[model samples]
Target: MMDYQLNTPLNGNLAMTSCFHENKALQQDTTLYKFIWVRSGILTVEIDHIPMRLEQDEIACLTPLHHIEIKEVEGEYLTFLFNSNFYCIFGHDDEVSCNGFLFHGSSQVMRLKLSPEQSTNLNDIVRIFRQESTVRDNLQEEMLRIILKRFIITCTRIAREKCGVTPEQEKAFDIVRRFYILVDQNFREKKQVRDYADLLFRSPKTLSNLFFSCGVPSPLRIIHERVEAEAKRLLLYTPKSAKEISELLGFEDLSTFSRFFKKMTGESVSDFRKSNTTGSIAN
Candidate 1:
């Protein structure tokens, strides 16, 4: 593993690292949202067990749910790591449409291969992050937030395009957007598509159609994934037992939760927890 770590800025929400890969391995699981910009060379990463090679001018946005191992990095690369709290501020604001299109979007479509002009634009924004870090002014955090918003907006645009998202279809987009928010907020209490459909004043079929049209996954998958994400987080970060976790996620019983988890992730709850903990130990 490479012995490199980024210095945390005064606003600890953000950190920057610059390094060149040469026969080095940096492997770990991360809970923060990570943006890695490949300035030059090839950077290889395994996110959620899928290996990706990002070349020059390409960037990867990894959500907190991913387990990433930096398999190999050759050449220069820059990384910006921040928590979802920072990214999700200004709730439901159009300025930072990051909740679905960027951070919380599908892990399969997270990377953005930048064009030359887009690369220059984003690189310039990155320079601003570097510049703002050197100052201790009262407005430093404010400046960093503005820069971060721009970075997110730029990435969101490219990500939407990559995912074939048509945000201009306001009615369909809003339905799906609301569905995402409702699932995030109520996945524990509402697991079925019919439940969400009732809340959205649309039939289950209509709701599912909207999600499919917007390139969103199936409603049941989204709801189950959200619940499973919380289950994994609690299992990894909390000292809660299976029964306790099941209760916290509003499951009727531990048996049902275990079966659901196994069905969704192809692993038993105890096995999944052990796997994650074992990886943490290995790291």
Candidate 2:
């Protein structure tokens, strides 16, 4: 379980390893984005308490905000961890265009199954990544960034293809991507689809239509699911009371949040917390 890491004083951090469990420090770092590629066998992960399984030749792209628990790994895998300082997705969105589509585009974890050719391409890039990790020079950082950008571009292309996005829908796709980013950024304060629609300069109905055409979740459902996911994460991982979480999530009052939670999920806050806590303890 060898870990190869590159760290710079300017907060540039990147770590690569074949064993995902070996990097406890990186796993706990909230500021890092994670890419988990299952090269062989099965990998199980729980994101925001929802478990997912990845088979061979699959990869999951995750953002900093997600609560990720690597439950099991049955065979070989690769993990790439990097902070914003290494390469800010938002800062260089125009270059790779992965800011929204790969990381923050959906409430669910983004997993892509690689074709044989795609897997070969990724393996080639990873070889270069391993080789570059050993080199030290003034241009090492830039070189690594270039490789990372290439990796991101490859994943973005696969994602676009998997989403069935056509060239004709590229403009609409960008709008949907922007909507996802905006909802991720503002869901705590802005709970309505109309809010995001206004920010995207589209009407709520138009946003719904676009999402429908893309076969993605509806705009309102995306907002509700994002809020619900955060609520569940706080409940399962934090000691904050419901009132505190309600305030943190920008609810006017506890009752409103309580009702929203019950509507989104089928349980009250206390019950949800207790059930998950007991489950964790048992585990």
Candidate 3:
């Protein structure tokens, strides 16, 4: 297992993007709605723990809560991590990579890569990111919004080129889309597989089959993913105790929660909190 130590949660807000770098083997972690564009070198990228590679001129977006890292890849890439949800905009189609990674399934991410002009549009967008980044505009939020939009468009095109997706990929992508959305909404009260099946109107076995075909983990594992993500969120922001958070997140027993949390994130709840200068998560 990779010794994935999280730097910190980048807050719950969707529009506040903090720029930073990840040391190799740190398993660079952050919670943000953003995109990454590789200026140079190959980056071993992962989302939801699925890994893929990002080469030069390749752009990555539509991250549904990313757990990415640079791996052994080196050289700085222009990463324009942004939070576009703060200003609710509507644009995009559902897309998924047939190759792997499972990093993006949202429509906007589907169409946000380089264009046919052969990187002409992307070059322009990169220039904009550089310019805005240098000036540090006061309307930083909105500036990032626009720049990211352009970068996304380019990324979509690039993705379509590098990896021609398959119909099976489309099916897997849809399942992931609905699965992620449902998990986010119901992870707190409904942690069981049957709970999600009831809401999606699909049988647990059927749903499990779909996810498996799409290379997604089992439904139960999906539940743990959401719960773990929320646990990290609470650990970072709210001053909640382990017992409180476990109960709030639908865990029935404190020891069960502790065991699972440690398994998902190779750290105790208290140690995680303490690393960030927070009090022990035990009340």
Candidate 4:
């Protein structure tokens, strides 16, 4: 079961905390970026609506300020919050953290199961994060950036090993990651895969191969997934009726949009919204 306990914000910005035992996740509606590191036990992580199961030493990042919720959060977890202004301290002027809850910038979000050595190193950062009050200095920013970057590097290496991709394949995967970022950003504006491939200066076939190599679906499939995500968001967040949303999403007719939504998400837009209001996962 999923439950939520909202946390009070610190400053005019975000807040970081240490989790004890959580019965419910927190519902944060902030545009500022948020992060979490699993200190112990397991966490079911969802960022911008994408879900993953993360164990100890695994970290999650979120941006785009979409719905990021954690389920099955037992034992210890450390939460961190950041945004453009905050991350600028790290000298990352345009660095994007994946929707603030996901680690999908290829190397940035490698799944790391902390070995003993790595765990010891990460503890230093966790220790700092857990302290409710600390000295905020130049060193503090450097420490957080180093800790966060190293964590992602480690996780990406682990993810590569698990996926059986070599160094060359890994490079391709980075390009694929960039494609996704672009597609995600422009999904509502640019619907077709070619539009993305053209912008990326690659053929659709090359884009398809890149995704296929990364263990995801084809480029077109990813585009559809992007479109479908917007449809679901419209369904859940807006009080606007389905027909209006369908038209707004660029569908010619209500029937066409309804059919497309059903084909992609396996339910009518109205029913999808209805069912999600009822339960976690439904048929």
Candidate 5:
């Protein structure tokens, strides 16, 4: 078995730790976000059934609700765990726009291969975090938040570069983003493109046009996907019954949810749960 260091939790909002072995499998908490930085290792990780390989100086961002397994590790790694409350201290401001693009994104994990300079920069930030974590002064929380903001912003820059996102393109993507925000906030009870359009003060046609221009699926498709995603999360992660999950997702009855799940995932809710439950986590 691999040895592990359980660092003390900082203010109940953040936990920092390091591991240096091929330890037992670990799963992430659904209520917190995680950043895994491989200082010097070749690690194979599985996130939500997708296998990923990380090397030295690489970083991976995982959001709440992702099922992660550290399949194998060779060398050392550092990880930071924090809740969304700590991340969104400025509320829903667009200035620090990482909530959607990094965490809670369609992709379960975002991996960034750090350049040498980038690696050095991130390492310095992590050093500060480690140094501050040892001291519990009044300014510790504020300083941690500031450092975290800097790290997230840096990661966002890398993500933007990897995706080739330009300012003009970002401007054009505003409509698509707003549509997703509305869907995320209201998909439980509202599943129609027209409803989202109304919320965004845009016509259905306009929304459809923007989605098309942005090279994404149509508004209605995105809404259905969001609903399906949440339904799957509930089915796999929670003990709620099919009927309860259906009602929680705003479906009128079990049959309706059954049909919807079958249509979207090509399987019944029961079968999906049975297949996903056992391998989801390790205690």
Candidate 6:
């Protein structure tokens, strides 16, 4: 297990490791975005209470809002972690163009499976990352950011392909990605497709058409799912009562929240929490 880290005075931090357990503190940092690449073997993890398995040559892109628990690893893996201070995806979206597609696009974790050729290319970028990690210079941060951008660009390319997005559809895909970002930022306050459509300066019908053309989930469904995911995370991980969570999530009242939860998840809030707690204890 080898680890290399670069830390800056301005709260910028980046780390690369072959073993997931090498840096427990960084993994627990909610402000960090993580790219977990299963170089070889299988890696099982629970993300936002849902268990998922990643096979060799697969990568999972995780945002700070995700709750992840590494369950098992049967072989070698690589992880690259960076905080927003290191490189703000949102701020630098124009440069890397991975702000929403790779990080905050969906309620579920974004997993990309790599071809052998793609795997080799990513390995080359990672090798450069390793070499740069040992060098300290005035331009070190900039150099690393450049390499990181390349890595993200590569993944975003693969993601576009995986989603069946063609070069011609890039503009439409950008709209969908922007919608996801807006939902991530405002789902707590704005829960309707029309709300985001207004922000994006598109009609609700246009947004739906764009999403349908991209073969992605509907805008309204995305908004609802994002809200449900956050509610589940709060219920399972925090001691906040349902009422408090309802208010925190901008629900008009507890009953409204309860009804929303039931419609989204097919269970009452208390039932969901109680069952999850019991399942944890049983495990």
Cα-based lDDT for every prediction: 0.72, 0.87, 0.57, 0.59, 0.72, 0.88
Error of 5 at 35 (Å): 1.9
After superposing candidate 2 on the true structure, give the runs of residues whose Cα lies further than 4 Å from its correct spot. 105-107, 278-283
Compared with the true structure, the alpha-carbon lDDT of candidate 3 equals 0.57
Residue pairs with colliding backbones in model 5 are none
Instruction: Provide the lowest-lDDT 10-residue window in model 2.
Output: 274-283
Name model 3 segments beyond 4 Å from true.
Answer: 1-32, 41-75, 85-121, 127-147, 153-164, 236-239, 263-268, 271-283
For model 2, residues 1-283, the per-residue Cα lDDT tens digits are 5478888889899888887576677777888888889999999988777789989999999988787788998988898888899999999988988877898834487889999999999999999988888898988888998998899999999999999999999999999888888988998899988899899888999999999999898989888888888888788888889999999989999999999999998999999998777534211
Summarize candidate 4's per-residue lDDT along 1-283 as a digit string, tens digits.
1121222233223345565234122343354554567887888865545577888877655543355656567767776654444343224413422221143222123344656666676676556544423545556554555555554444445455656667677568666766777776676677788998899899988888778767876877777776776677666656777888877777778898898888986887777888665444311
For lDDT, the strongest prediction is: 6
What TM-score quantifies how close candidate 5 is to the native fold?
0.79
Prediction RMSDs, each to the true structure: 4.7, 2.1, 9.1, 6.0, 4.1, 2.2
TM-score of each: 0.76, 0.95, 0.56, 0.72, 0.79, 0.95
**Rank order by TM-score, top first?**
6, 2, 5, 1, 4, 3
lDDT of 1 at 79: 76
Q: What alpha-carbon RMSD in Å does predicted model 5 have with respect to the real structure? A: 4.1
Model 5: per-residue Cα lDDT over 161-189, one tens digit each: 77667787786576676676677778888
- Which of candidates 3 and 4 is the stronger one according to lDDT? 4
- In model 2, pairs of residues that clash are none
| Number of clashing residue pairs, candidate 2 | 0
Model 3 worst lDDT run, 10 consecutive residues: 1-10
lDDT of 2 at 46: 86
User: Tens digit of lDDT per residue, candidate 3, span 116-230?
Assistant: 4756777676666656654544575566556655555555446644454465576555555567667766788887899888887889999888777665578898778768866
Ranking by lDDT: 6, 2, 5, 1, 4, 3
